[model samples]
Target: MERSTGVQAYYAESAERLGEVYESVSFEDVHGALLDLLPEAPARVLDVGAGTGRDATALAGRGYTVDAVEPVAELRRVAERLHPGSGVTWRPGALPEIPGVRGPYDVVLLSAVWMHLPPEERPGAMRRLAGLLAPGGLLLITLRRGEPPVDRRMFDIPPEEVADQGAAAGLRLLRTVAEGADRLGRDAVRWHAVVLQLG
Candidate 1:
């Protein structure tokens, strides 16, 4: 699948700025709503779209083995430098077809990443994510809710849409957190966490 041109251009140009912005927030603060759903430490994790290694490094600190998949070279470089010796393996890949990364992870996280996928790519991405989960593993997808930025490609995907697609992929919808305020202080932006389990 072709990547969104806006996503490519924007991240490439502003990777360092975005990295600083994203790393400023603690992972726990951002994912507080779904903390209860996380499996205990030592569980394998896949952090897709791990822009700056913030989430992946935090999970590593908590003793989870994390493989962070990021498609952008600039972001990956920034992430690795920001969290050296973090024990988080950086992989080059993206959604719908995460090339070079094989998984049966205990947890798969797509934080603020789903919105980047166009509508036509969602189903395939959902199926691919489901396929990467170990039996009974959790798939935590955080959906961004807000207007798309004029400079970058994004969609305010609804939780219902994710849940439906997950179901079609044979995943059980375990939980859906109500939309919460954006941690970045964007007035119009909010977030919803959708948790699914592999049968």
Candidate 2:
């Protein structure tokens, strides 16, 4: 799937920033989230918009078969280098149309990629994402909710909006974990990690 102009810019900036700190970002939260959904053994996992392959590589190392999808060429290259011989199938593509990876996957991860999608495209994207899941498969999404960047090109949706989108996509919400705080103790930059069961 061809990305929109806004998505291209968002990815370009993320690639640049991630290149510098790709190795340092903690994967504990991501790994724990995935493990919580698939606790017994290795399962087919799809890491959507897998920038730098941090989560994908970690899952592969733990014996899971991961299909990592990244649209940016530079990020794909970085992921390849970091996960050499890690058995991770790297695909060049964006959300809703993952190339070379067929699913029905046990888990589909959309970490930190939701905000990059334009509001108008979000519903279709969510439905397409849910379509990739196997029966009883889990769809894990991490939404960053807060003030939008000054650019105003992206949509910073609230957690309620995220839940609504999931329902519209035929996904049943299983749980939600929200965190982060603003200056006055109000939640700012809320990281809503939601679990959904595919219908």
Candidate 3:
């Protein structure tokens, strides 16, 4: 997919910022959500657009085999360095073109990554994402529910839109959760976490 140069630059900057914030993020919600879908036993997982290895590392620490794919070279390097001996494989590439990672993944995670794609490219991307899932495997995605900077086209698509797109991509929506606004509620981003199954 062709992105405007301005959008590319905006992502580059955002990737750097996200790398810095990865460690500080509260993963409890995400972990709880994943556990509700996945079996207790460790499973092979793929972290799509993994920014700085937070989720991948956490999963690996729990004995799950993890392969993390990140497009930003700098962020990939940072993740690799931070998680030395973490047993998580870090690949530098984007979604739909994850290098050296074979899937049939028990879980494919697209956290905070869907909104980065140009709105027009999302369905195709989701289709490819669905293809990576093992039969009955979960495709977990969390989209930020608001407009991003104008230079970049961040998809602020609603929950219904996401469900519709999931159907178009041959995915079945198993669960949808809308998080409450954060403390202060002003400019607080609400997140839509959807658990999808590829039929």
Candidate 4:
């Protein structure tokens, strides 16, 4: 997939800043709405666009095997160094065409990544993600809402759009929560999170 230079630079040039933001985020906070849907311990997890590996590291600490796919080189380097031996295998990959990452994961997570794709790309992306799920697997995605920042590439993606895409992908909607604030305390930013169960 061809990535926008702005999106590339936003992550690469601002790795340090993004690292600090990701460092403060917790898996519990982000996955609270979908906890009940997640499988039991020792479940295989795939965290796509896993920034800084914070959530992957946390889940790995609790005995889950995690495959964290981070496409950014600098962030992957920092994440590996920051959370080594956490039972999390960090792979370099991205969405819509998640190359180099195998799936059938018990849980698939996409934190703050859904909005990065253009509206038309969502259905195919969701289909690809759904195909990666194990039976009864859960797919959790958080869509960033509100106006996009000047530094990065994003759309003010709506939760309904995501649900529609998921439905087209043959995923059953489990939950939809639209009240999360920015973990970095960005007032201009908020989140729309969704949980889907694959057939």
lDDT of all predictions, in order shown? 0.90, 0.74, 0.74, 0.82
Sorted on lDDT, highest at the top, how do the candidates line up? 1, 4, 3, 2
All models, RMSD in angstroms = 1.3, 3.5, 2.7, 1.6
Residue pairs in clash, model 1: none
Off by over 4 Å in 3: 1-8, 14-17, 29-31, 182-186
Lowest lDDT 10-mer window, candidate 4? 1-10
> On residues 23-96, what C-alpha lDDT tens digit does candidate 2 reach at each position?
57656744454456663457888888888888888878778889988888878887787768988898888755
Query: What order do you get sorting by TM-score, best first?
Result: 1, 4, 3, 2
Q: Write the per-residue lDDT of candidate 1 for residues 1-199, one digit (tens) a residue.
A: 1267668778979999989899989999999988888889889999999998999999999999999998888999999999999999998888879987788899999998998898889999999999999999999999889787887778888899999999999999999997678898999888899999999
**Candidate 1: stretches off by over 4 Å:** none
**Taking the tens digit of each residue's C-alpha lDDT, what string does model 3 give over 42-79?**
78889887778888888888788898887766677778
How far residue 128's Cα lies from its native spot in candidate 4, in Å, is 0.7
Q: Write the per-residue lDDT of candidate 4 for residues 1-199, one digit (tens) a residue.
A: 1155678667877777878877886878766766677677989999888888888898888788999988788888888888877878988877788877777899998988888887667777888999999888889888888888776778888888788888888888889987668767889988888888888
lDDT of residue 195 for candidate 2:
84
* Per-candidate clash tally: 0, 0, 0, 0
10 residues in a row with least lDDT, candidate 1: 1-10
Q: For model 2, name the residue pairs that clash.
A: none
User: Where does model 2 exceed 4 Å of error?
Assistant: 13-17, 30-34, 181-188
On lDDT, the leading prediction is 1
Lowest lDDT 10-residue stretch of candidate 2: 179-188
* Residue 42 Cα positional deviation in candidate 2, in Å, after optimal superposition: 2.3
TM-score of each predicted structure versus truth = 0.97, 0.85, 0.86, 0.94
